[model samples]
Target: MTKIPRGTIAIEEAVLNPDGISWMAESATLFNTGADPKKASSHGHTPQLLDIHESRLAKMDAHSVEYMLLSLTSPGAQGEPNREKARKLAADANDWLAAEVAKNPARFGAFAAVSMHNAEDAVFEAQRAVKQLGMFGIMLNDYQVVGEGGDAEGKKYYDAAEFDPFWKAVEELGVPVYLHPRYPQTKDLERGTRYGDRKQILGAAVQFHLDLSMHIYAICSSGVFDRYPGVQVVCGHLGEGIPFNLWRADHWYNKPVKKATRPSKEDYSYYFTHNVSITTSGNFNTAGLKFCIDQIGAERCLYSIDYPYDTIEEAQDWWKGVDLPADQKEAIGRGNAIKLFKLPLEL
Candidate 1:
C-alpha cells in the first residue's frame, strides 16, 4: 500500500448491486450503461464495481485514499419508468449499500438513491435513507425517466413549483444532494443529430457533462436555491463546466430575458458559490483544477475518482502532482469533503 495520506476522501464514488445490474441491463433505455446487460462484465470493471472488499478497498489503500463516499451509479433508480419499481430499486439499492457500508463504516460512506418521479415519495425515501439507514445524502441522476421504456413523454426535472416539498425536505434533513450525470433522454438523443458524426462520445465523453449541466441550469435558474438556500448540491467534472462560464452565466441571468422567466433572487454565480460544491471525480486536469480554484476557491472543491470508471492509480497520480499550495491541496483533496458531507473521518 502507498504511504497513507491524511484523511483523504473521495465524495462521488458509485456502487450498484447484482440485482441493479440485472435490472438496469434489462430495462435501461436512456443511457448506454443499460444498452446491453448481457455484455455487462465485458467492461472488465465489474469486479472493481462490485467488490468493495479486495478490489475497492485495496485500491484505496494502494493509493493512500483514506475514505470513499459511495452513491448509486448513474441511471440507477432514476432510469426506471415505473414509479413503484423505481421506488423499490432505490430502497433495495440503499439497503444493500447500507449493509455493505456497515461492514466498513470507517472506509466508506454512501448517498441514498431516490426516484424523482414523485416528489412526495422521494422526500420520504430521502428521510428514511438518512434517518433509518444512516446514509449520508441523496443522489439524483439528472432527471426522472417517467416515460415507459425511455419515451420522451416521461421526462421530469425538479426545478418547478411542484418540487418544493422535496427541496424543503432535503433542506430540513440537512444532507447534501448530489446532482450526478446521465445520458440524454431518447427524444433528446434523437434531436442530437447535430452530433451524428462523433455521437460515440455522447454518454460519458462529451454529452454527459452537457446533459447533466442542464439540470444544474434548472436547479439554479428555477429558483430552487433562493427558497431552500441551505440545500447543498454537488456536481462532478469540475462543476460540470460552470466555473468556466460563471462570468457569462451571471451576466446573462442579470439580463432581461432570464430575469423575466425565472424567480431566482440572485445571479447564477451567487447560488453556485453559496449552495453548490464541485469534485475532481473524472476530469483530473491540473489546469481545470487551477481554474476552478481561482474561480470558486478550494473550499468548494473536493477530491474524487469517479471510481471503477476512473482508476485510483490515475487519479492519485494526477492529484499528487497538482500545482498548488499544500494548504489548498489539503482543502480540496480531503478537508472540504469531510466538512461538506459531514463525513465521520478524523482530520
Candidate 2:
C-alpha cells in the first residue's frame, strides 16, 4: 500500500451498483456508442466503479487518500423517468452506499443520490440519507425529467421555483449539493447540431462542461442564495470555466440595459465566492489549478480524482507536486473538503 499522506481527503470519487437500477445494464443500448459500460471501454479506469470493497479501499490506501466521498455515477437515479422506480433505485443505491461506508467509516464518506423526479421525495430521501443513513451530502446529476422522459418541457432544474423546498431541506440539513453533469436530453443534444463541427470535434468532452455550466449558471443567477444563503453547492472541473469568465459574465449580465433579466441582485461572482465551491476533478492542468485558486482562493477549492474516470495515482502525483505553499496545497488537497463536508479532521 502506498503510504497515504498523513491527512488527505479525496472527494468527487464515484461508486456504481448495477443491481440498484437497470441504467447500468441498459447503458450500452442507451449510449450512442452501443458498447457495454459494464465491461468498460474508453471512459477511463472504470473497474473501481463497481468495487466498493478491497479494490476501492486498496486504491485509496495505495494512493495516500485518507478518505473518499463517493457518489453514484452520472444519470444514476436522476435519469430514471418513472418517479416510483427512480425513488426506489435511489434508496437502494444510498442504502448500498451506507452499508459500504459502514465497512470503514473513517475511510469512506457517501454522497446520497436522490430522485428529483418528485420534489417531495427528493427532500424526504435527502433528509433520510443524511439523518438516518449518514451520507455527507447529495449529488444531483444536472437535470431531471418529470412526468415523462422524452418531452423537452418535462425537464426540471433545481433553480426552478418548485425545487425551493428541496434546497430548503438541503440548507436545514447542512450538507452540500454537488451538481454533477450528464449528457443533455435527446432534444437538447439534437440542438447541438448547430455547432455540428465543434460538437463532433470535442464530443462529450466540451459539451459535458457546457451542459453543466448552464445549470450552475442558473443556480448562481437564480438568487437561490438570497433566500437560502446557508445552502452550499459544489461543482467539479475547476468551476466549469466559470472562474475565468466571472468578470465578463457579471459585467454583461449586470449592464444597466440588460439588468432586468438579472435574477439575482448580487453580482455573479458574489455567489461564486460565497455559496459555491470547486474541485480539481478530471482536469489535471496545473495552470488551470493555479487560475482557479487565484480566482476562488484555496479555501473554496478541494481536491478530487473523479475516480473511475481519473486515477488516484494521477491525482496524488500531480497534487503532491502542486506549486504552492504547503499550507495552501494542504487546504486544496484535503483541508477544504474536511471543512466543507464536516469530516472529523484534527487540524
Candidate 3:
C-alpha cells in the first residue's frame, strides 16, 4: 500500500489495435499455428491494451504514472514476409500510434516501429517516425525475419554489415532503439525446446529474453558500438540476464581459445557501461534491480511497467518498497528515462 512518488514515467507499455487499425491482422497471420496470434501474443485483446481513452488514463492515474511510452505489441511488422508489406505495416502502425499519442501528449509518448525486413525502408520509416511524427524513440521487437513467403528461415541481426546503414541512421537520428524481446520460433525448433509450441509459457517468460540476450551480446561482440559510438541500445528484463554474468563472458573474451582480431577495442562490459541501458520492465525483482544498478549504475537503469502484462500498481508498489535512497529511486523512476529518451518535461 505504498504510495508512488509523483512524476513517475513508465516506459515499455504496449497497445493493441482491435479494430484492424494497425498491422495486427497481417502480422498475426505469420504465426499460422497459434490461436489468433494477436490474442496469444498480448494475453488477448484486453481492455487495457486496446484502450486509449479514460480507461487507460485512469490506470495511469491510479499508478501515478505521468507518462507512458507506448509501442506496438510483439512480432509487430517484423515477421511480415514481404518487405513492402512490412514497410506499409510499420508506417501504418506508427501513424496510428502517433495519433494516439497526439490525443494526450502530456500523458503519452511513443516508440516508432520500423520495418527491419528491408534496411532501406527501415531507415526511411525511422526518419519519418522521429522527424515527422515526433516519436521519442524506436522499439524493435527482437531480431527481424527476412526473406519471401514460406522463406521465414532467414533472419536479420543489427551487428551484420547489411544493417550498417540502419545503425548509422539510428545514430544520426539520435534516438535510442529499445531492443525488446520476441520469442525466437526458429531457435525453438532447432533446439527442440518447444517454445513455439507453448506460446503461453516460453514466448514471454523464457525463450524470448534468452534469444534477445544472445542478440544483445552479438551486437556487443560484433563491434556495432565501436563503429557507431553515439548510438544507444536498451535491453529490458534486467539486461536480459546479461549483467549478472559479465565477468565470465569478459574472461572468455580476454582469453579466447581461437584468438583472432577483434572488432571491439574493449570487452562487452565496456560497451554495456558506455552505450547500453537496461529497464526494470516486466521484472520487479528487487535483488535483480540492485544487482543491475550495482553493475551498470542507476544512471543507466530505467523503470517501466509492462502494462497489461504486469500491472502498473504492482510495479509502482514494488518500486515504492525498494530499499534505496529517494534520489536513486527518482533516477530509476523518472530521471533516467527523461535523460535517455530526452523527454521534454516542463519540470
The candidate maximizing TM-score is: 1
Q: Candidate 1, after superposition: displacement of residue 44 in Å?
A: 4.6
Q: What is the Cα root-mean-square deviation between model 3 and the actual structure? A: 4.0
What is the TM-score of candidate 1? Answer: 0.91
Tens-digit per-residue lDDT, 243-320, candidate 1: 999999888788888787767888877877899989988998899888888888788889988987888899999888
Q: On residues 1-347, what C-alpha lDDT tens digit does candidate 3 reach at each position? A: 43334667888898866644344444333334455644654244455678876777887787678888999877777766578877877898899989989987878899998888767888999999999999989999887887764434578887888888898999999999999887553444533456544555555567677888998988998878888899998888889999999988888887765235677777888988999999999999999999988988888899988887788789889888989888999888898888889987643
As for candidate 2, its clashing pairs are 4-64
**Which structure among the candidates has the greatest lDDT?**
1
User: Which is superior by TM-score, 1 or 3?
Assistant: 1
Model 2 / residue 36 / CA error / Å:
8.5
Q: In candidate 1, where is summed lDDT lowest over 10 consecutive residues?
A: 25-34
Native-referenced Cα lDDT, model 2: 0.81
| Cα lDDT for residue 241, candidate 1 | 90
Predicted candidate 2 versus true structure: per-residue lDDT over 1-347, tens digit per residue? 44335756878888887573445544332334445546743333345688877887787777788888989988788877778988998999999889988987878889999999867999999999999998999999889866664563367788889889998999999999999887544444445464432435222367778878998999888889988999999999888878989889988988997687677878778888899999988888899988888877888888888887777888888888878888888888888888899986555
lDDT of each: 0.82, 0.81, 0.80
lDDT over C-alpha atoms for residue 98 of model 3 = 92
Ranking by lDDT: 1, 2, 3
**What residue pairs clash in candidate 3, if any at all?**
none
